[model samples]
Target chain A: MLRLHGIVGDRRDHALHHRLHHLEHHDAIEFLFVPEADLGRRRLRALTDRGTECAVSLDRDDALYDGAVLFIDDDRAVVVRAGAPRELRLRPQGTEGALKLGFLAGHLHWRVRFEGTDLCVVLDGAAADYTARIAPLLDDGIVTVVGNAN
Target chain B: MNAPALSPATPAKTAPAARVGIGGPVGSGKTALVERLIAAFAARKVDLAVITNDLVTHEDAERVRRSGLIDPARVSAVEAGACPHTVIREDPTLNIEAADDLERRFPGVELILIESGGDNLASTFSRDLTDFWIFVIDVAGGDDIPRKRGPGVLKCDLLVINKADLAPHVGVDLDGMIAEARRVRAGRPVIVTNCRRSEGIDAVADHLEREVLFRT
Candidate 1:
């Protein structure tokens, strides 16, 4: 059962999450509300045994693990906590012209716009003086970092 | 006859002092109630700590801290993650942990008051988490609320109808509302108060003294 077990955010959010957890974890899926106050891996295992699929919704802006069931109540604020195994989102930022040139050379074409920092940004920063850093490796499955105003 | 002998194989455990919860909609005067309890408990010299849940702001927690009745650090606030009922009822893990943390921080504390974030009806505390609880509603919401009989109102140990002074201005029949509340709960305790003015606080305190604090 997909029991929400417990909400991570605040005390007043239990019922709705309980309802959501129960609804998602329906018959045959044993749902248990585990308050983090008393949470342990053993508790997670216990729920897993109750049902095959285990899903937990985290607190507001909270990210624990990217479990099967994620509770997204509102999107106006930053997600401080997401129960997903890995919370992936776009990040944005503003930098000097040279930094922007290197940044674009690394990920100029992308599916989603994000201000996040990854290996690409880190590499780009280190190779700031090298002009042909990424151009040669772009087609070879190797991401390169080159910053030039051309 | 002699009492049964203790078993040698039994595990030893501390009787963790009971935890009590107080919840209700916003503007129902939960902070005011806490203030009153602080004064009342101080009169009785009870050692206690309070945990408050604020959905979008720390105003309530701040109020109790600044009240000067208890140490400001004795109060901690938890954010509601935009969904108040989930934290208190559905999940309640963070609140439980916070309460336990407080217990760890202050061993002398005998009473714990967990205030839920301001939320709508249908909010209730977990029996496993809280030993007893109270729900506060207000006259400003109208007198028919009792008749609606939300789960929170029906399940709470004490139902407080706060802001009594606004009944006439708000066009509510205060007597009828209180009577209907009694009718709904059958024999449960209900208190009418103007928490803003500190009226009817002692009666509420009296109920807590007997029911939760176990001073009797």
Candidate 2:
């Protein structure tokens, strides 16, 4: 039974490095990847299949990139995964359309992006189901498409 | 019914430099205000350095560095990675590190101005990032801005209405806008400024000197 706590970067000065190296050499292992959005303010994340929980306490400013490993043990390890990218593509008809869309995304705490004439929001899961949620908030001329970018 | 008595703690250590934040919507005169502040603070012989956050480019920081108002070395730019608000509010570590580096390089610096990447009404600085902050909005943005009562407008230490000269051209009554701003703020101070002519700048400088810098 291993209790994982904090990111490797957060515990660089601790003796856990030696333990992690020794654990990595073991063959019997289970890997779990937690999506970035799910890794919110919670210090403990429950891994259902493993029937165990890992505590992730990265520094306040540390960014969890795609595929960031959070824990490593003799039998299991937890990873931070960005998951599939779903974006809301918007087309505004009026002069203020682009600005309004950008503002609305930021106001709603969504990460905004622009590719040529289209404004995009990397969808925040069910919390920001923009197709079912945000499209109605815009004026008539604005068009919204929610799907894979590629 | 009485409030608990306060306890006096150990003597506090003097802080390094004072940090001020400037934030507002795009095209709202945030960079202009920074330029004006640089000159004004320099004229008063205040030691100053600046950190700028740009959404995807270093254009704003480059403009200030090229302005000849202060040494180019005194300005540093942090890319917001397109999430401007997060860099200033949610996770200000990048900005904190930048400011710490600036202070380390210029030990005599008494002030550091952090300019946020152009953002919307909800944008604000984290308390951990700035000692005081000013939210700038312009007449061209429409007088309804204050009436909207966005967090930046309602919660900033000071609110500045810039481009006062454009009020007439934009069909906005400057007096009505200022009146509504005051009403929404519950009588907090609002300064009207035409940064182009440097009107009402001294008042802003005076406020910072007295309130933030404690000059006199």
Candidate 3:
């Protein structure tokens, strides 16, 4: 079993991205899919695409994110891909609502991304857990769920 | 309880240093306590590092570094910006990163003291950031503080009632305040300290040695 200590670099880095692009052509890159809930975990045990056993123990401060390169060599590379997460899509009424929604999300430290005027919350836990927190905003009509809450 | 020794079959790995957080309101002597702890830990010859979260400047970090107690290189500072509690509680990534940097720079360090920016009594440290945390509240703040039962007063591993020397001058009943604190915490430990005189510091250091460092 390979014991991985920390990430090499993020795939978003231009240099690393170029390296990954080159590795893709040779099929030298292997991926380890981790659940969204486990992204914050410091220690994890998982298997690579090629069934390579791996034990990941990162520093207490380190958190794995999508496109995190775990290991790479001239011949092969391993990257972490976050599994699909349950998302909560919300559309705030206006600027005031947007600020409120943002504040709520920031306070809860919820992972979020904005697409146009819509806010997409990538849930680390059950949908109800996220919904319950923003229920007040929903009740106030400051924000509306755009799709299935789950 | 002490962690069991790793089996001979297991590959040796350096254990991460224990992270301890000190959080409290403004002017509550949080930095003073840090200075005192530096001297105390120095006397014991403990390998220690410090991380200070200042609201908008490196004032606390600079003071500790210039104190001639610990190495200036061993002290790191994190600017907490506007929301001090957010950096320590809601999202502690910055503080955690600072501590990790300290551990990497000083491999032999056994303890890292993280001091949060001065905040209200409700502020508390996230468990991910600290293995053990101490909340400082001084008698000058008010005897009613512990009675308020803020999360910092209730949830902290240790509650330090600093400024013990000013109890009478401030019209605070020290014994009654300590009693109320004990009652609110349901018999958890509370220590009173006069940082000016270094009184009660030994007890605080002893608690850390026993609980955090596991030096029984």
TM-score of each: 0.55, 0.57, 0.58
Candidate 1 lDDT at A65 equals: 30
Candidate 2 CAPRI grade? incorrect
lDDT of 1 by residue, B67-184 (tens): 8999988898888776887888888888888888888898867678889887777888876567678899999998998899898899887899999999999999999999999999
Query: Tens-digit lDDT track for model 2 on B112-216?
Result: 999999899999888667767899999999999999999999988789999999998999989999999999999977999999888878888887776556554
**CAPRI class assigned to model 3:** incorrect
TM-score for chain A of every candidate model? 0.19, 0.41, 0.54
The RMSD of every model to the true structure, in order and in angstroms, is 20.7, 18.3, 14.9
The list of candidate 2 runs beyond 4 A from truth reads A1-150, B1-13
Worst 10 residues of 3 chain A by lDDT: A37-46
Candidate 2 lDDT, A48-121, residue by residue in tens? 22333333333333445544556554443444445555566777666666677666666654545677787776
Candidate 3 local Cα displacement, residue A29, angstroms:
44
Candidates sorted by lDDT, best first: 3, 2, 1
DockQ in order:
0.01, 0.01, 0.02
Please give, for residues A27-126, the per-residue lDDT of candidate 1 as tens digits.
2222233344323211121232122333232222222331223222321111112221121221223343335444554444211122434222211112
Q: Lowest-lDDT window of 10 residues in candidate 2 chain A?
A: A41-50
lDDT of 3 by residue, A1-150 (tens): 555667889988898888887865565666687877557555556676556656665667677998899876666677888985457899999988899998988777565667899888866458888879989988999998898457
Which candidate do you rate higher for lDDT, 1 or 3?
A: 3
